[model samples]
Target chain A: MTCTGLSAFPLTPIREDSVDERAFAAQVTRVAAAGVDSIAALGSTGVYPYLSRAERARVARVAVEHAGDVPVIVGVGALRTSHVLGHVDDATDAGASAVLLPAMSYHPLTDDDVVGLVETVAAHSPLPVIVYDNPGTTHVTFTPELYARVARVPGVASIKIPGVPTEPAAAREHVARIRGAVGESVTIGVSGDPFATAGLAAGCDAWYSVIAGTLPEVALRLARPALAGNAAEAEAENVRLAPLWRLFTEMGGSIRVIATIAELLGIAEQPCLPLPIRGLDGEQRRRVAAVLEALQIS
Target chain B: MTCTGLSAFPLTPIREDSVDERAFAAQVTRVAAAGVDSIAALGSTGVYPYLSRAERARVARVAVEHAGDVPVIVGVGALRTSHVLGHVDDATDAGASAVLLPAMSYHPLTDDDVVGLVETVAAHSPLPVIVYDNPGTTHVTFTPELYARVARVPGVASIKIPGVPTEPAAAREHVARIRGAVGESVTIGVSGDPFATAGLAAGCDAWYSVIAGTLPEVALRLARPALAGNAAEAEAENVRLAPLWRLFTEMGGSIRVIATIAELLGIAEQPCLPLPIRGLDGEQRRRVAAVLEALQIS
Candidate 1:
């Protein structure tokens, strides 16, 4: 089935040095309760690449078990196709309903490289694959032509477009272009929580989100208007979510912001970021608090 | 010990799905025989990230064993600092003289982040560290100020600058700036095979080379005059090496070109490039052969 509506990529909570399974499961259950369509474990927000294979597998297993009726979408992005195939197997073995595969590389990927990667990965994967396009993280951006090529791969169910450029014109144009290229055969979802409303207003089918993982109710409040074709209403809510979005932009990634949000919401502990990287400082945390307070999220 | 002179990053040969140890050892032995100053196993040319931890450890072990008196610099770059620390231990256990680290990230790193990462990794590492700057792959560039900061980190012994802009003027200025900033405590070397002569003439201490690994005689033919301060002679040789350099430029990376070079020299079989990535096609292979023929390297 095509992935649709809001899907939560819940933060993989770290208690001490381990994946806090109880906290992780609870986060999934909480988002699932808020009526998100799917729970994506080990997504960018989940820090999949930073975690060891065993840790990732456990995260997926717990995610699937706790998701209940909500489908579980595991991020299976890796540098090598063999490694990605291994992750695909892990997702299937963990009982995930779908897998999100980003074209991850430390090198520049040619068009044929990306197409070959997705097709080979989809061929081996039992679960439907959602091609994730987040050039900010992977340095591999997919044009509409590239998306169309990936969409035609067997077992590919959807594509998640990243929120980039920030300018409403570029964001809107990008979504429209992908929709036109892929047509109705592939589901179109928007990632980068800040641009969800703009993507939805531009006719995206789903929101692959970060905020929804913690503040699902608030995320739903923002998404519902856009999903229902009320562009004016969605844009208004996006204005309210502006402070939080600014924090994401400032941090250069969602990991620290989401972790701080969870800590504020009392859903998780201070994130145990993979070593050499620390969580947000007091100033950043204070800003996060102010944003949450401004939005009245608590 | 500072990394200096013509250090070779020999391609890790793949036989079936595994690192071909015998062929890998032979490659190292051959380069060392040609009198390269060091041997860097698992550098970009080695595809360290594409291999599993076990495979990397195996490659490191084999590289150290075959390197003889030549210093073996193992690439220990990883996404997480914790993973990097693990690799440090692996490098130490393998008996490598030093470890080469690129500021590997899926996200763009800030100045503080880069400094923090290198300091932490160096603190935990048993072997001395060489900071690798390859923006084409990592998307992280180190300014002279940043290199100075990294150089002060206790265990960091050197920095490897890449041949970017390809223009000799900017390349020379970049090397000079780093040298001015860091002083003599940290050795500065250059990578990108074609830029070795320019780098050496620009006052870099070494050429951390790709071509040196497979075509050591030719690589030395270029490096000797440059090392001896014969700029005119080195530039002439660089011009002679221009045809091969163009192939490297066309491919956007050195992996395929080096792999093709090894195959042409009968050092190894067609690389089994981690699946979904095919070797050079007939046209590319024909071009590689023509370049090698013109160079008149038996």
Candidate 2:
């Protein structure tokens, strides 16, 4: 999973206030069937924090059961270190290859706190750990120094850097800075789907993708060219999803848009996201529908 | 509990990765014995997000059992609405007078999401709700318009607005704007200890004090005069502990500084915070200890 390929992140569907395991397994099986390099379950897009430990374990088992040969990376983030260890054990029991640990903050956390979390997980879990640096959600931003610190921990596999700067040189330099700190042993994966091509072109080892989970063929079209040194081709394909990325920015986040896409394309149930997150309004859903129809993505 | 008096929030002490129930009960009892208006358990200071449902329920029960005549307000915030509802039930079962619901986010929440959370809880829970707007922790800033919306809910008792503007005219205007939106029915309690006098002087109905949990006498010295229409007296008391406020800012958050203060006073054990938090380094603890001694706070 920690390689120069696409690791798809699927949104876990919930129905009647419970994990819709049937639809969720279908989503994972579809992504695996579409030939994603890896299936990363319960990422931010999957609403990991909104779920319980037992529900999360069930999702991990379903993902591993359905994702065929694609290695499943489970999100094992919690506010407490003890709870995180418990999740790591559950993920390992469910046969996940790696666990994505976001420095989930209730009180603002220091660099030392984040490092302590990664170290504790590394000490306890048998599976490889991905240091998930998602400042947008977690509030704890990781410096290159922090990344290098965690990368040195035993069983640490990949570092999921939030998005690279859009400019080619700056993105490359940013990636290089992280690379110089973390060295060649640990993989550097790029998230934030809008910058996927730029990050892959700039030497990020993997594209930990959102769109790929729902539309694997489409993400691969944009990602494969960039990973293979044809940045222009990838950039062109990525530009075609301009409406989507624009919608994501206008919508304030990508999860709702991705969920709407899943529902509109008959991939998951309507109102797929859990409670408190009312996926999208009717007008917004109509807009998503129009975009899907216009792009022939359905 | 929603009146113009101090609502003290006590930090839940953790020992060996479990809630030190005896120590926590002692903390609650100390605050109750000191005659605070209400005892708020499992607040940001109480580490509500880090504990499990069972742990939270136990903590809530302990707070109620220890707090004699003082009503206990338990914080029941969770990432999911369903889990929050479950916590609401637990708090009610423990005989909490009200439940504090911060719009805890993993994905950033829109006004609709937050309003929906409040609405759902209001619809189900027997206890009155405190719409907690601590953007410093939860990241969901509640605008005046949003305040008006949630205040319309049936059982909404209070709105814990974060620190008000410091200037006299501006702070009064700020509190007035919220008061106008929420109306006279919802008690406008203020958080952020340093701004206690300003918020109280500006017509905030309550002071949600953090340090009051450990040092009720100290917070009451600052808070009581303001509640009695003597702003200058409250301001003088607040200014006396300027060093304490400065330390809160320097330490990133008040939790660890307060935890260290508790440990130094022999009220709670060392390393009071849950792991991944690492209360304070030895050097930092020494500084906190020095502050307590110089100020005669210990």
Candidate 3:
């Protein structure tokens, strides 16, 4: 149950705008079968905010059921404190090993507000908490000082930072600054799939990844070496994924591209993402399909 | 029901983490009694995203009931398209005259996503839609080109643009640009209290005032002249209330400061904001109180 390796975040596939439970179970089972460190369900990659309480609870249950012995971490996000507490309760009742909590701001949360959210959730949920920071989407960035404050809250086990600087030394310094702030207690997990290996080389403990959600082996190629402290090997793996990373950047975000990957590989049904977020199709779908072929990702 | 005068946005007062219906009714009645053109319930100042569907429906009904002859524009924002549709249905059933729809992006929505939201709502709801654009919070800035596209969508009756540029000529030109996009059909309502008079003077059709929600008379002192085409009188009033506007700038946003104004006046109970969004207290509280007195707001 250590938070120190690849934690796969699978797509919570939708069929007709509802959680495709059968497809979701298959997604989880595949990632578990591929031997991930843990299964982090309902992260942004899972489209957490779009799902209803009933849907989220059911998804969490499905994840726990099919994830075998993989420690299941569910993302608990809502605009209101009480509503977030409701999600934490649902995550707990569904038998999750830990809960991933984000500021999830509709209005940008003040530092005091974000800290208060952490304290409230930590106080109520008996499970370990991973503080999620994705400023691009959440619009609430955490200074390392703030991270120091949040990670110290009781039951907080990790900090899932957006991405570290790509340069080797700067990434190390960045991780070091956070290390000095949070010390040895909380794990530092890097998100942002492209920078995953570099962040690991910088001494991050885990990769809370998007790519690992569907294509675990491809992600594991970069992760295993970096987690094993072989920077050159990890960097080589990352260098080879330049094409896939380009696809993510070009598509505006990882969700649509990843969903396209899932659909092309038959991991999930077509139009898996919630409505309003279109999955890539036509020429774009062909482009992703070509990348999958060239990289031999499937 | 033309969207062309001062539209008040009252806070949805919260006590014990539940909607304070009595206080809300009082707030609505006070605005209605002041003869404002419309009462826009559950706009940003209303803490719209924090409330439940049932809470929003009840608040919409209360606003309609207490508004007397005034039109009640209910904000029906939710993350999913279907949930938003459900809110629209509730607003219709509650006898709301129109519904205000913000992209309400938890994930920053694409142009297609936002337009799809408008098209979907327009297809279903009988009431007109106001495209609420507050990019500082919503994080989805609509281009003038995007505005033209959204305006053309059937049932989009208004566009509540954020603050216009400060300089008089610049403000006029900015409003004129939006004017060109939305044209004569869709009303252009201005948000941002500090920018309200300037936007109105610059040819915006309405002033969506947060300050007016707590103190309708004070807002009318400026709105009345501006709506009547007396820009000089409106400018004089805006300059006179410069201190109040400064508080909003210094405090980051209008919600907390306005909530302080409401609570200090006993218009609502203390801790009116939903949990995690702490109301101004102690010295900050005193600053707002002193400003209210200096401006003779109550």
Model 1 bad stretches (over 4 Å): A15-17, A164-173, B164-170
Q: Per-residue error at B21 for model 1, in Å? A: 1.9
**Residue pairs in steric clash, candidate 1?**
none
DockQ of candidate 3 is 0.74
Q: Which segments of candidate 3 are over 4 A away from where they belong?
A: none
Residue B188 deviation, candidate 3, in Å? Answer: 0.8
| Ten contiguous residues minimizing lDDT sum, candidate 3 chain A | A272-281
Error of 2 at B57 (Å): 0.5
lDDT of 3 by residue, B45-111 (tens): 9999888888999999999999999999999887788889989999999999999998877666789
lDDT of 3 at B87: 94
Superior candidate under lDDT, 2 versus 3: 3
TM-score of each prediction: 0.96, 0.99, 0.99
Best by lDDT: 3
* DockQ score of each predicted structure, in the order shown: 0.60, 0.85, 0.74
| lDDT on C-alpha atoms for all candidate structures | 0.85, 0.91, 0.91
Give interface RMSD (Å), model 1. Answer: 1.9
On DockQ, the candidate that comes out on top is 2
Q: Give fnat of each prediction, in order.
A: 0.55, 0.77, 0.69
